[model samples]
Target: MPQSSNVPNGASAAPKAKYNRPKPVVLAVIDGWGVAPHWGGNAVTLAKIPFMNKAMQEFPHTTLQASGEGVGLPPNERGNSEVGHLNIGAGQVVLQYFPSITKAIQDKTFFSNEVILQGINQAKQNGKRVHIIGLVSPGGIHSHIEHLYALLEVAKQQQFTDVCIHAITDGRDTPPFVSQEFLADVTTKTQELGVGSICTVSGRYYSMDRDHRWERVEKSYRAMVEGVGPTAATPEAAVAAAYRDGFSDEFIPPTVIQGPKNTFKPIMDGDTVIFFNFRGDRAREITQALMKPNFEGFDRKKSVSNLYFVGFTYYEEGLPIHVAFRPHNVKKSLSGVISDAGMRQLHVAESEKYAHVTYFFNGGNEQPVKGEDRIVIPSPHVPSFDQVPEMSTVQIADTVIQNINRYDFIVLNFACPDMVGHTGNLRAAIQSCEAVDANLNKIAQAVAQAGGIFAITADHGNVEQMVNPKTGEPDTEHTNNPVPFIVTGNAVVNCQLRSGGILSDVAPTLLHILNIPKPAEMTGSSLLVVQPQVARSAASTL
Candidate 1:
C-alpha cells in the first residue's frame, strides 16, 4: 500500500515530543478475560495463565471498567467486543446505538423516522405484507426483543393486518434453552398489540453468520422469502421440535410456519422488510442476501421485486438500504493520530475478530489510514469453536512477532477465549486460556527482545464466569465485570499506573508512552502516573 500525506478529517497534528523513544509499543487485547472474586465457574482463576499472572505481579497494572457506562453503553449493560474496541481506540466514550434507539422510542421519534415510515407506508399503501426480522433475545448484544416489539407496534399503529416476524433464536448470547421463553414473550406481545404473527423461525447460526458462510445465509434467505424449509404449526412448535431433535437454540434449522388458511406466507414482490438489530457485524451478510440486487453469495431460488429493506443501523457503507439510526461520529482515533504522525502500525487478528482490530478499533472507518497495515488469518470452519479450541492464536502470535520490528505500533486480538467461552464448555474455555497464555508468552518475549513495551488488556468478561451462580447452569452471556490492564517491558521502569481507569484510557496511555500529544477531541487522560520531578523536567524542557 502506498503512503499518503492526506490525513483523516478529524485527525490533528501530533507534534514531536522532546522525550524521544525509539522502541515500538505493542498492545495485546485478550478478548473475554476479566477479573472475578469467586473461584467457582471462574475459568481465568481455574486455568493456568503464567504470563498474565506474572505480569500482574511484576508490572504496573490496574483494573479498568469495561462494562456499562464506562464503555458508553446503557447503564448495567455488559460490554461487548464492538463497544469495547471502539472505546479502546477512540480514547473517549463513544455512545453506542442501543441507547440512541431506546431514547428514540421513549421520545416517540422512532415511529416518525423517515426510512421506517417509508417502508411501512409503502407496504400499507400497496396492500402488501410487512416483515420484521431480527434475533428474538433480550441479550442486548446484537438485537433486543424490545426493539422487535417497537417495530411490531408500528405495524399495529399503521393498521397493517398482514404483518409477520422472521424470528432468529440466539444461544451464544443467552442461555442455550431460553429461546422458548423469548419466543413466547414475542407471541404474547404481538397478540396484545393486535398485530403481526411469527411466520418463520431460524437460529442465529444460520441467520447471523459473519464469516462469509454463504450456505448458512442462503438457508435463512430461502426460508424467509422462498418458503423452502420444514413447515411448523407455530413458532413455539418449531423451537420445541428443534429442542426435541437434540438441537440447541443456536443450531435450529430454518423452518417456515403454516398460516391460518393452511398455507405458508412467503415474502411477496411488493413486501417490505425491517431488520431490527442495533449491532452491524452479524447483520451484514444476511442484509446483503436480502437487499443486494447483484448478490452472488448463493442462488436466491426466488427473487422478490420492489422489496424495500430497512436496517436498524448502518450495516456497511454504500449498501442499497435505508438506516433507522446512523452511527455516532468518532474522530481523532488512535490509529488516525498515529498515521498523522507518520508512524507505521499493524493490526492483526483472525477472521472471527478481524473487524475489531481494524474497523471498530479505527472508529468505524472501513478503509485503513496511510502507513497502517492489516493482516487477517483465516479461522477454522468448525461447527463450534470448542472443536478447535485454539482457533489460530499461534498463527496470530507468529504474525505479530515477525512484524514487530517493522511497525511502530502493533495491535493484535486473540479470539480463542471469547469465541470458545460462548460455547458454555468450561474445559474448552480453560484450554483456550492456556493457548492464549502460551502464545502471549512468546509474543512478550519477542517484544522484549526488540526493546519495546508490551501492554495487555481485555475487551470484557466471558471466559471468567462459565456458570450462572443462581441456577448453576452454564452461562454464555457476558458479565458486568472489569478487565485488567498490565504494562510491562523497558519503557516503564518505575512508572506507576493509575489506580482506576476505563477502556478509553488505553489509547491515551499508549500515546503518552510514544511521546505523542493527545488530540483535543480525546476526552480520556493518560493512565501513566508521572512523577513530579519527571513531569517538571519535561515541562521545563518543553
Candidate 2:
C-alpha cells in the first residue's frame, strides 16, 4: 500500500513558526444552493432565506461557475458531487471520472485493461461466477450504464458462462421513472450475448451508503441474500409497483426478480463481485460489505465466505484493492496545504455529505491529516429525504457553535437542498432552502462570536431552478447554473475575486486568507482583493 501525507515533500507538515494564526475561517459549502432569477420555480429565490439574501446584498460576493467545463466536466455537462467537491478541495480542476472513463472505453483501453483481465482470469481459475455490480443509470453520478455495457461485452468475449449483474437502480440524477427501462435494456443485452444475467436489483439509496449507515446496507444484503423487501414476478412488475407506491425509481426498496425455473438466485459464497462505479463515496461502504470479513458495520446474517471483491478503481490510495481501471490520483489538496501550514482544521458535516468535507476535500485521501478534527452527524433515516427536508441542519449548526473556537479552520457542508432537490418536491425543496437559511444565521453568528471569517458557496445548482422550462414541472436534475460565493464577518480579507471565478478558485482563496502560499500544482489563482504580506510589502512602494 502506498502511504500519502498532506504535507508536501520538503515542507514541514506542522507549524514551524506560528506565524500569527489569522482569525478563524469558517468555510461553508451549502449543497445545491445556486443563483437563479427570483421566480416561482427558483427555490432559493422563492424561499424566505434572510441570511443568504443579506450576504448577497452586503457581503463581498460573486457568481462562481459550478458546472460544465468550468469544473472540469465535459462541455455542457452538469456537475456532480464527486467532481465538484474534488475540484473545490484540490484548488485545481480535476478531470471528472465520466469523461476520463469514456475516453478509456472509446480507446478500447478499458476492455483489455490488466486489472479487469486479471479479475476474469482469476474467476476462471477459481471456478467462480464473476458478478458485476453498480448503479444502473446514465446520470454520470455513480456508475453509468455504458460502463456496464463494456463489462458485459468483455465478459462475452472471454466466453465467461457464470456471469451476473447486481444493478443498483438510480432515479435521482436522471428522470424519476426509468429503472424498468434500464433493467429491460440490460437484461436483453446480457441475454443476447448469452454471458451474464441480471441477478439482483435494488435502489442506490439503500446500497450506496456512506457514514456507517448499516441498516441501509443490511436492507441491500437482505435483498440479495434472502429475497427480502418487495418481491416481483418480474423486473417490469417491480418497476410499476415502485411507481404505484409513489416512490421515485431510484428510491425503490429492494426487490428480487424470479430467476429461470422459478427460483430465487441469491449472491452466495465463491462469487467474485466487482463494483463498477468509478466514484468512491457511496461505493465504499457496500464494497466493504462484500469484501471485508467479520464486517461489523452491518450484519450480513450469514458469513459471505471466500468471496473475491474488486472495485472499478481503488478509490483511496491508502487502501489497496484489485481494480479494473486506474483511479485518478488527486494530490496536493487544500487539506495538505493547511496541514503543511500547521493550521488546526475541523471538518463537520452530516452523514449525507461527511465524506465531501473530509475525504473528497482532502484530495480523495481517506486517512485523516495529522491534526484534523472530523465530526459526522447522522442524517434522518427515511425512505426519502423530502420526508425531512430540514435534515440535520440544527445539529450541524449546534456542532459549529460547540467547536467554533477550537479549530483555526472549520469546514462545513450543509446537505439539505441537494438531497431534497433530487426528490423533485417543490414544497420540500423550498423548505430545505428555508432550513438552510435559518441554520446559516446561527452558524454565521457563531463564526462572528469566535471572531472568524465566514465564506459561503455551493457545490452545484439543484433547488435553485426547480422547474424544467420545457415541461413546466419540477426538475430533479442539477442545473447548469452559477452559484453564489460570499465572504463576510470580522476576519474578512480585503480581497476581490477575479472575473469568472469557478469552484477550483475556492481552495486557493481560502489558503490565501490563512496566509499560506498556494501549491505550485494548483492551477486556480487566489481571488483575494490583495496579495499576501510577502507580495503586498514588495508592492507597497512600487
Among these predictions, the greatest TM-score belongs to 1
> What's the TM-score of every candidate structure?
0.94, 0.90
Off by over 4 Å in 2: 1-21, 227-230, 259-264, 315-321, 490-495, 531-542
Local accuracy of candidate 1 as per-residue lDDT tens digits, 1-542: 21112333323234342345446789999889989986789988888899988988888899999989889889999999999999999999999988888888999999888998899999888888888899999888998888888888877788776788899999988889989899889888878988878989999999999989899999999998888888888888899999999989999999998957224678888789899998888999988887778989998888777788889998887678888898888889999998888787788889888889988999999888777878888888898999999999999999889888877889999999899999999999999999999999999999899888899999999999999999999888898889989888755755789977999999999998778889998899889896887565544322
Instruction: Quantify all predictions' global Cα lDDT against the true fold.
Output: 0.86, 0.78
What local lDDT does model 1 show for residue 509? 91
Which residue runs does candidate 1 get wrong by more than 4 Å? 1-19, 259-263, 533-542
Separate clash counts for every candidate: 0, 2
